[model samples]
Target: MRSAVTGTAVILAVGALVTAAMTTATASASPPAGPAKADPPRPVLVDCTWHKNVRPADFILACGDGNSRLIGLHWSQWGPHGATATGVNMVNDCDPYCAAGRFHAYPVTVRLDGPKPWKKDPSVEHYTRMSLTYTGARPDAFKAVMIYPLWD
Candidate 1:
């Protein structure tokens, strides 16, 4: 009898949680609230033409993935295999809409690795991938090194 009662209680608790989650999800179905958003441009490199002296230490890169750009890049090491750079990526909480002005910054170690030929332009080379490993607080975030490809 006690085991049966316990099972019933567990089932009721799970049902309640499921119901609450459903309610929350349904309530947020409306369009996100925030400032007006301009259509995101195609996901291309912020600037494919980057040089050592000309490129700024910090810049805005619109990677049309509807997230955020890599901010505050301070390169400490550079080589053929990869370039180690310290930077900040503002993880945007695009609750409803991507262009919503909700962004949070976190320190990240960037790796521009796997040099490859610029398929279209044979004269130049590009980093096949860019990896980010967060070195700061991770609330609702991950410690994984997420790799993103770079394009001309």
Candidate 2:
């Protein structure tokens, strides 16, 4: 009887170990937590051709996307050939020329549900023109060539 009980105990222990291993494998094989939020689809540029020396603006813009908060207007002036020109970010409400010569992209986030002209149509339908210039040794004039809106 003693030998029989010991054999049964060993068999039960092995079964428990197998069950635990199977459970772990099943848990790991299952998908992760919740589904990730997919990024918003890109909107077509309806009126981007008319704006000369302006960056191609994005329409489906959001407030807090992985890229930027609001829409950003970028401008740069290169040398004779296709040289690298200084890029500027013109999203601040203050003077556009406040941070001149800084080769950095500026972002301006606007409230879609705020007051004024924006609140009237808070459906991601807004536009603004930004003027920028290169303040380097050889300063070159360039306006916000593109206006990209955020989505998602």
Candidate 3:
């Protein structure tokens, strides 16, 4: 009768240990707190029509549409590798001259963001967003959102 009690106690102790282990394992398998991470957005490609072989008087971006143009740019630095220029943008401000409109010069700073993708064509490259931090001297009615990359 003593041996039978001892065997039963051992079985009960083993079952208790197994239950504790399973509880610990289940807790450990639970997902972590907070939201899951999402993938970052891809880099947008520069418009194909905006390519330039020669830097314009003002850096001209010949977009696919004839409406948009960067008419004049005086580059302090320019090359096949990279270039930086400061000039006025002769943009078609949908104002008095919608059709044969007068292109006005707005103060601008132009820069080369990185190296040219195409090796054969040295002058062509990418650019960054315009810094319109200008206060009083800034263009009239120029919105921060309206600014885009004037290419290299």
For 20-110, candidate 3 gives per-residue lDDT tens digits of 9999999889986778787532222244454434444643354554444454556576554455666655556656656766555566665
- The candidate 2 region of ten consecutive residues with least summed lDDT is 109-118
Model 2, runs deviating above 4 Å: 35-152
In the order shown, what is each candidate's alpha-carbon RMSD?
23.1, 15.0, 14.7
**Which pairs of residues have clashing backbones in candidate 3?**
57-72, 57-73, 58-72, 58-73, 59-72, 59-73, 60-70, 97-101
What's the CA error at residue 80 for candidate 3, in Å? 7.8
TM-score: model 1 vs. ground truth: 0.56
Q: Can you give the TM-score per candidate against the true fold?
A: 0.56, 0.25, 0.41
By TM-score: ranked, best first: 1, 3, 2
Cα lDDT of model 2 by residue, 1-152, tens digit: 99999999999999999999999999999988898897532222223223212234342222232221223433242122221223323332223453342333443322121111223334423233222232432213423243333121
Best candidate per lDDT, number? Answer: 1
* Model 2, C-alpha of 84: deviation from truth (Å): 55
lDDT of 1 by residue, 52-138 (tens): 221236644444563667777888866556677788877777767766658878788887767665566555555667788878664
lDDT of 3: 0.52
